[model samples]
Target: MSDQVQRDQTLDISQSFIVQAPAGSGKTELLTQRYLKLLSVSDEPENIMAMTFTNKAVDEMTQRVLSALKSSFKPKPKEPHKQITYELASQVMQRSDEKEWQLLQNPKRLKISTIDGLYSLINNRYPLPSQLVPRQIMAENWARDNAYRYATEQVLLMIDDKQQGRAIADLLLH
Candidate 1:
């Protein structure tokens, strides 16, 4: 499927390309095959990223690409003994033409992290803009810890309403 696509007129790197495949028309196979082909020739494979909707899909896609690449990734005449390196990854991650890869590799992004990480970045970028204190403080985890301690101290001072106090404590603790 991908071999045909590759063979089909030159896939213009300068222009965007989209293949609209209907339901159950080997879309996954074609996409993955094309992904591997692009990855092989790509100066920055990290740049040519593909996203699947689910973790299962991500796992499947990653495994398929790894396996396919492993099968085809052999020494060639133009590049003898050429192997994909971590340095090449770092280089591609550092710079790329793919927007998806750029977003995935951006140092500024907080991957699967709490909102606190985002707030911290925002605060560091612009304290006033992010509605945070201008001074440098501890990380989000540390601040959350300190807030919990302060809340506990407040609770210990005096609190008759058990439910209200617990709610207050929870808020401060988080």
Candidate 2:
């Protein structure tokens, strides 16, 4: 795709897009720009989520977005990519100022995290239905195995309860 078209698509927040490109191909830049655009138009900072595979990417993207917002307060950038970032950041900063978001003061409002982090956030916010314990996702296989074993033990213990046993049986039968 043409660069302009790709840029346009990235700025379009009305729909979602899966951006796939080789490393060092500005995918992060595009995503950061999109995130800034979303922030500019959104009232709730927590509603805007950007998920990546690794915590490293999450940190990088979060830093990039924050840096862009900070940089926007300075003079305009010379580089084309940075110029775009500055503009988007300026818009977001304007909206944030109007809404009194205080993003710079509280950057944690930005919902940029790894997929596992997002899952954990959801699990913590809305707990699982019954005696089923919510499992914390881990990157290491050993941790995952341990969590699974622990959850299984909890479920087994719950099986002794008549009501819980019936719920488990119903779930297993389905």
Best by TM-score: 2
Candidate 1's TM-score reads 0.37
| Tens-place lDDT digits, model 1, residues 1-174 | 584554232234454556666776655555555554454356544445565556666566665444433334343324321222222333333434443444233432212223454455556768674556555454766788999999888776645566676776676678
Worst 10 contiguous positions by lDDT, candidate 1: 80-89
Give the total clashing residue pairs for model 2: 0
Clashes by residue pair, model 2: none
In order, candidate lDDTs are 0.49, 0.89
Backbone clashes in model 1, listed as residue pairs: none
lDDT of residue 60 for candidate 2: 98
Number of the top candidate by lDDT? Answer: 2
lDDT of 1 at 130: 58
